[model samples]
Structures are given as C-alpha cells and as structure tokens.
Target chain A: MTSWQIIILASIAVFALKLAGYLVPPSLLERPRPARIANLMTVALLAALIVVQTLGAGTRIVFDARVPALIVAAGLLAVRAPFIVVVAAAATTAALIRLLT
Target chain B: MSTARSSQHKAAIRASVAVGIAVSAYGISFGALAVTAGLDIVQTCVLSLLMFSGGSQFAVIGILASGGTAAGVAAIASSTLLGTRNALYAIRMAPVVGGRWPRTLLAAHWTIDESTAVSAAQTTPEGQRAGFWWTGAIIYLGWNLATLIGALIGNLLGDVSQYGLDAAAAAAFLGLIWPRLKSMQPIAVAVGAAVVAALLTPALPPGLPVLAAALVAVVVGLTNWLGPKDPLPAMQQLDLGEDGFP
Candidate 1:
C-alpha cells in the first residue's frame, strides 16, 4: 500500500477500535488486565520511540547532537516548561550543538 | 437546561477552551515533525483530522520517516497499539458520550486523553457531558488548524535535520511520556524498554527493536515485580494468581 493508503488504513483501524469500545460489552472494563497492559504498552512504546528517534539513523545507532538535546528537553520538562517550549528547546539545542561541534 | 446545568456547561466550556488551546498549540510540533517524517502537508493534516490521537500519529510518522514502509508493517502495528488506549478510554466515556449512531460515532472519535480527562474532572453528570463535548470540539478544531499551520511552516523549512527536527521528534515523545513516569513500575518500563530497544537496534531491523522491546514492558508489567508492595484488596486480587500474568 502507498503512504496515503497506509495512513488511511491506520486511521480507519484506530477509529474502528474506538467505535468498537462503545459498542462492546462494558464487562470488558471489569477486567483491568487488558486496560492496564494497554497503558503499560503506551509508556513502553513511547520510551522506545524516544530511544530510536534519538539514537538510530537507519539501522545504525550513532550518538550525536540529539542526546544533549534530549537531555535539555528532559530538563525543561522537569522544570514544567510548556509543551512547545520543550520541543523548540530540544530542536534548538540540537541545532546549536551540531553547529558548534 | 437548569441554571445549575447551564452553569456547569459554562464552566466546562471555559476549562475545555483553555486546555484545548494549550494542547492544540502543541499540534504545530506534531505537524512539523510529521512533515519532517516524510508526510506531505495534506497527509499531515489528514492524519491529525482522522487519527486525532497524538501518540499514534507520532508513531506513524516516526516509522515512516526512519525506514519508510521498508520496516514491514511495523508502523501500523505500533500506531494501532498506541490507539488501543482510546478503546479503554471509550469504556469510561460511553455513558458520558451517551447517545446513538452518528453521535456515538463522533464521540468515539473524540474519546481521547484530553477530552476524557476534562470530563473525568467534573463532579456532575451534566458537567461531564458538557466537558466531553466542549473539550472535544475545541481540541478538534484547534488541533487540526494548528496542524495545517505547522505543516505549512515545515514545508518552508527545507532539510529538517539541520534544524534538529529529528531531535524534536524524540523530544516530543519524551514530552508525552513525562507525565506518566510517576511510579516505579512505569519508570521501570521506560528505562528497561529504552535500554532493550537500544541494545536490539543494532542487531534487528529498523522497526523490530521497538516492538521487541515492548515485550520487556509486558514482562515487567505482568509480573508486577517492581510495582508497589501494597497489595490490592483481596477482592481485586482474588482473580490474580501468583504468576500475576493476568
């Protein structure tokens, strides 16, 4: 499938999951395992994404400007900076690091 | 509507608009990142409009940007896995979004973290519904609009890597994950999964590492090995055996 097809397919699949929840038996909610696992997977997957996007270039893992940028991002987040600030700071930090080194 | 309901509606609208604007402003980052991830402006906008789930949309673009579709269906799998939380959200939101057919369908689309959170914060049933509807509407509009704006800006800024948009993508993920890292188990999930995925990245294919690392989370989560020592009350624990797989 093309990129468009892939994106659309994903959208439909996710929407279907959401719609199914409304239609399905609420008894599923009684079982906390599935929901908890889902939550846990979200956390895990996101953390993994951070690692991949920061360190991986294609299949090769290269430590570069992104590491300090990510550290800055984490620091900004720790200080309760707004979302946009955190993101922009990360980008700027990386750009500056690359420019200098 | 009674005076109380009307007041509740007013309050919900106020709260929703505030959060909606703040969160939607961040959509620009997503838009910029998605386009940097190889999606066109149209594709980026369509994604936010349709998927409307921040984490899942990021997953889609993140995968696409790195290895293209050559990653072998990992994009869809990871994106859908993230969207699974919306299904769980819908369970809590069904009654708040109570209705039939088209209305319910729309509610499902809006059954996301922000709207659910706004609704859950309310004390009254009316307030909950009002919060859900208001937050969903504002966020839907603001998020899509901001996505368009970001996509346009991203298009103008060629060669995104020099601008560090790649790092911005990772930072975006960190931003999303930050709030959830409150407990030992979740912290363990993040640290373990990150290290494992990092370790596996060199050996495995582009996307496989992340997927494989998710197993670590499943193991840690299922075992509850690092979770709080305080047990669930007996009634809740009745079903969970020693293995704690369930």
Candidate 2:
C-alpha cells in the first residue's frame, strides 16, 4: 500500500486499539495482574523510548553526544530540577559536546 | 467548583500549558523533518493531525529519512508499535472519563502520554477530567500550529542535530518519567526496560526492541500475581487511586 493508505489504515487501527481499551470489561481491568502491568508499562515504554532515541539512529545504534546528554538529564531529574532546566541542561550538554569534539 | 477545586484546575491548566509548549517545540523539528524526509506539507500535517502520536510520527519520518526500500512497511510497523501505549493509557483513563460515546471518541484521540500523565497527577475526579481535556486541547493546538510553522520554514532549520533538538524527545521523556519513579519497583522496571532495549537495538528492528522490553512489565506483573505471597512494601505504598499514578 501507499503511504497514504498506510497512514489511513494505521489511524484506524490506532483508534480501534484505543476504543477497545474503553470497551474492555471493568472486571478485566480491575484484575490485579493486568492493572499492575498497565501501570508499569508506561514506565517501561518511556525508558525504552529514551534509550532508543538516545542510542539509535535509524537502525544503527551509536554512542554519540546523546549518551552524555542523557546522563546529564538523569542527574538533573535525580535532583528534582525543574523540567525546563533538565531539558535545557541535557540539550546544552549534547550541543557543547558536539561543539568541542 | 469550590475555591480549592478552582485553584487546582488553574494549576493543572498552567502545568499543561507549560508542557504543551515544551512538547510543541519538538513538533517544529518533526514538521521540518517530515518534509525533509520527502513528505509534502499536507502529508506532514495529516500525520500530525491523524496519527497525532509524536513518537510514531517520528518513527515514520525517520524510516523515510533513512531511505529504506521497505520504508512503508517499516514505518507502519514502527509507528503501530509505539502507538500501543495509548491503548494502555485508554484503559487507565476509561473509568475517569466514563462511557459517553461522542466524548469518549474525542478522548480517545487525545489519550496520549501528556494528557494521561497530567490527568493521572490530579487529586480529584473533576481535576482528572479537566486535566485530560485541557492538556489534550493545548497539545493538539500547539502541535498542529508548530507543525505548520515548521513546515512553512521547511529546511531553513538545517541540521536539527547541532542544536541538540535530536535528543530533546528523550530528555523530555526523562523529565516526565522521573517524577513517577517513586520507589524501587518502578526504578527497577525502568532500568530493566532500558537495558533490554539498548541490548536489543543491534539485533532487533527499531521499534520492536521497545515492545520486547514491555514484556518485562508483563513478566513482573505475572510473577507478582501468581508467585508466592511475598508482600512488597514498595508495591503496597503505591496509591492505586484514580488520582494516583497508574
């Protein structure tokens, strides 16, 4: 299929998945196991995304300035720094590293 | 609304606006990148409007940018995988938003990470609804506007990497997730997922690694459910309320 077709189909699928979540029985969602998994899934997925975004470029995983930038972001987060500060600090760290090297 | 509730709503709105703007900053890059990746301005906007998921939209553009032969399939697969988390968000949000079809349909479109997080952070049901709607509206507006601006600017914003906007998404995600890591279980889960994704990066496809790492949560949840009745102090401390972290 073309990109247009793909986008349309994918949108439908995404909407369906979301609607299914609402349609699910409360009993199923209230179950301890599923609830716990859903709770932790966001954290897991976010962490995974962070790693992939930092390390991977297309299919190639490379250690670039983003590694240090991520470390800086994590440090700022550990200290409970403001969100803007953490983002700016991390971005600056990466920019400076790239500039110097 | 009472004075207290009104203040809470104001605070939620304020926070959501700030996050909306920050998240929209990334949208500028996405718009420019999508165009650079050979998509027309209309197509780029359509992705932002219809797909509406930043990570998945980026995945499609990134695959196209790489000029892969199977870019279509790869983009769809990668984007679909990243979009699954919205379903999880929906499950958590269903009870709070309730079952009105028209409203729920709109809610489904906005059932993204930012709205979900902002809503989940509230202490009241009204606040939850307010948070979700406000955040979703702001993000939708901000993201689309930024996309238009970025697309109009086009390649003028050359080499987004030099400015470190490339890492902006990851940094933003880190900031969002950091506040939620209240105890050991979550921290462990985050670390385990990150490690798994990093390790699998070289072996698996781009988005599949993240999905594979999600299995870690499933495994842990299953273990906690089926295994011996060892009480986890940290898990017990989790506030399983509509207002609490999910």
| Top candidate when judged by TM-score against the true structure | 1
Q: Tens digits of per-residue lDDT for model 1 on A11-68? A: 9888988888898877887765666667778889999999999999988899999999
lDDT of 1 by residue, B105-190 (tens): 89999988888777777778988998899989998999999999999988888797899999999999998888778778778899
> All candidates' TM-scores?
0.93, 0.72
lDDT of 1 at A70: 97
Candidate 2: tens digits of C-alpha lDDT, residues B14-44: 8777767767766776676576656778888
Cα lDDT, model 1, residue A34: 69
**Candidate 1 residue spans exceeding 4 A from truth:** B229-246
**Where does the lowest 10-residue lDDT sum fall in candidate 1 chain B?**
B237-246
Candidate 2: residue pairs that collide: none
What are the interface RMSDs of all the models?
3.0, 4.2
- By TM-score, how accurate is candidate 1? 0.93
